[model samples]
Target: MRKNKLQRQASTIDKKFLLLSLFLTVVGLVALADASAPLAQRNFGDKFFFLKQQIVWAGVGIVLLFIASKIHYRLWEKIATIIFFLSLFGMLMVFIPGIGTKLLGARRWLVLGPITIQPSEFLKLTLAIYLAKVSSKNKKLAAYFVPLILALSLIMLQPDLGTAIVVSTIGMAQLFVSGISLIYFASTLALGGVLGFILIITSEYRRDRLLTFFEQTRDPLDKSYHIRQILLALGSGGLFGVGLGQSRQKYLFLPETATDSIFAIIAEEIGFLGASILIIIIVIFVIRGFAIARASPDTFSRVLSCGIMSWIGAQTLLNIGSMVAIVPLTGIPLPFFSYGGSSLIALLIGCGILLNISKYGKE
Candidate 1:
């Protein structure tokens, strides 16, 4: 009977969810190897440096996923506050002298010797978990909303509007699914939109991005260069593409080829068909994730699953929208696909939590 129970529990795990995540991970690794080759070689004198590091991180993420999947989902609720504070501490460390690392005029990373991390990445995950726990208890809006605002203020100070937006969206989405009043929901969303607009227009670089999105001809080789190159890469892909690993743009012409603009490179190499396949996979992941959320056995698990789903789905939309010129480029990393260790790890861990919840979901 004990052996049979073990087998039954194993069967309750979401195999389709795990398979889709693995599929995306494999695709990301292959695409990063191709997209980062030229950039990595030029900067580090090694074509495979980034790819090798990414593989190591992916291995670590997989191990973490497995461990997290086996743990009880309820355990997170007990420590959600602790995790949030710890995440905040890490984010604060990024502002300290001699520890905070600045790149491209933004202070967003904490560099501790050979290990550098973006605390904001982990903060997003912890924030979602914290909010879900708070909202699950039917707490006052201030319980979740005020703290989220505080977090957003710090994130924006990092001058990372992309991450700030994504984090805020994830938190708000959790509140929405937690049975918040309709009036409160509409007001909060409107407020968020206005605040986002103000944040964008006040910052020179962000304002320029917005302006460039409207008028690409204003600064073709400067402010607008990234978007134009992205469009060119997509257009060049045509129907089938230039073929995998044959992209010319990765050779220093397109900016952020291996990071923010990797999707464009994918399109340029594998064509429209390949890009559509990726988009479809993401769509399916979102649908099935929500299905799990709906089937959750309790409020905390339901809210947590919904929050995680929003983080992945919203970020994916933002990244893809920027590349396609629908939204102004926000420098957001595509989940599972972007070449960032912290992002991939946080995402996989979230998936593991969702999987664990699936086991106890209402059948």
Candidate 2:
């Protein structure tokens, strides 16, 4: 007899993964409805244009989650290497002219006819699966990590420092959970940090970002403009906010209001309490994710759960930190709340994988 495999599946199918996604998706839609109103009204002549797009994408993501949730998480282990390589190829494809699209000087998107996809977004999940598979094969390799660092360099070549950092951090966290040699981990960490710093400081734009972080007021009209305005939005919110749909900042006063700075609009609308609650929900998600991972039966599922959780949690923290002047800016969005169809889809799929893992996780 399979002993209680069937019972476990029956019991765990709709556990924390479903619950967290439900909370996040609902909250994300609500926030997007609020944040996208001003930007949509100004750009699209409709208050709900962006929100509608998000709702459609969320629907598609839900379909994906529903489909993926029924599949076995172990299948990811089987295809992880192939997916990783294919995604790496996709990342490299951005260098090919005519095929790649550049919006603000940096090329990071692939345009195929009428459709475009950001490879870095897919690369995050690919790397997560690859790390989980590799760690399962040999835990020692987790410590002497370079594959992710190399991929980060490739992504940074696209000049997308934000995605690279998120991908790299998730990879590191996966390795950390694998319990590889600490000395090797430290060596990889120091080397990777030096390389990352070198890469950042060497670039004129990135260096300007760093310098702005140190003295934002020095270049108020230049590099620091984004930071200054973001801080102004945060400060203007004070304790209670400026009231719903009344943000003066979104009226062409803030850059990337629909993307990197979406959280600012939230702060400007509902104040500090709202932001704190959002953070609390994210923390709850992380806690539940790790608990499921820890409760998993197999090494692959364990690492996979950790990888997915870290991917969302670390990115969320970095996004919020950069928003409020706690860290250097990375133009990453706040997961589902940001106006990106691809990001939302990828995240929901990742969440689905977590659910699959939880269902079959070891006791």
Assess each prediction's global lDDT (C-alpha) against the native.
0.90, 0.83
Q: How far does residue 266 in candidate 1 sit from its true spot (Å)?
A: 0.1
Which prediction has the highest TM-score against the true structure? 1
Q: Write the per-residue lDDT of candidate 1 for residues 132-180, one digit (tens) a residue.
A: 8898775788898877988898898888999988998898889898998
Off by over 4 Å in 1: 1-11
Provide the clashing-pair count of each candidate structure: 0, 3
For candidate 2, list the clashing residue pairs, or say none. 296-362, 297-361, 297-362
lDDT of 2 by residue, 1-363 (tens): 476776756456646658778778888888778777777998899989888888888999998987778788888889988988898998899889999888887898899896688888888998898888888886566332667766787887888988877887888788888876799778878887898899888898888888888887977876899999999999998888899878888877888888889899889887888778878888888888888889877778888888888989888998899999989888898887888888999899988888777776655
Per-candidate RMSD, Å: 1.9, 2.0
TM-scores, one per candidate: 0.97, 0.94
lDDT score for residue 331 of model 1: 96
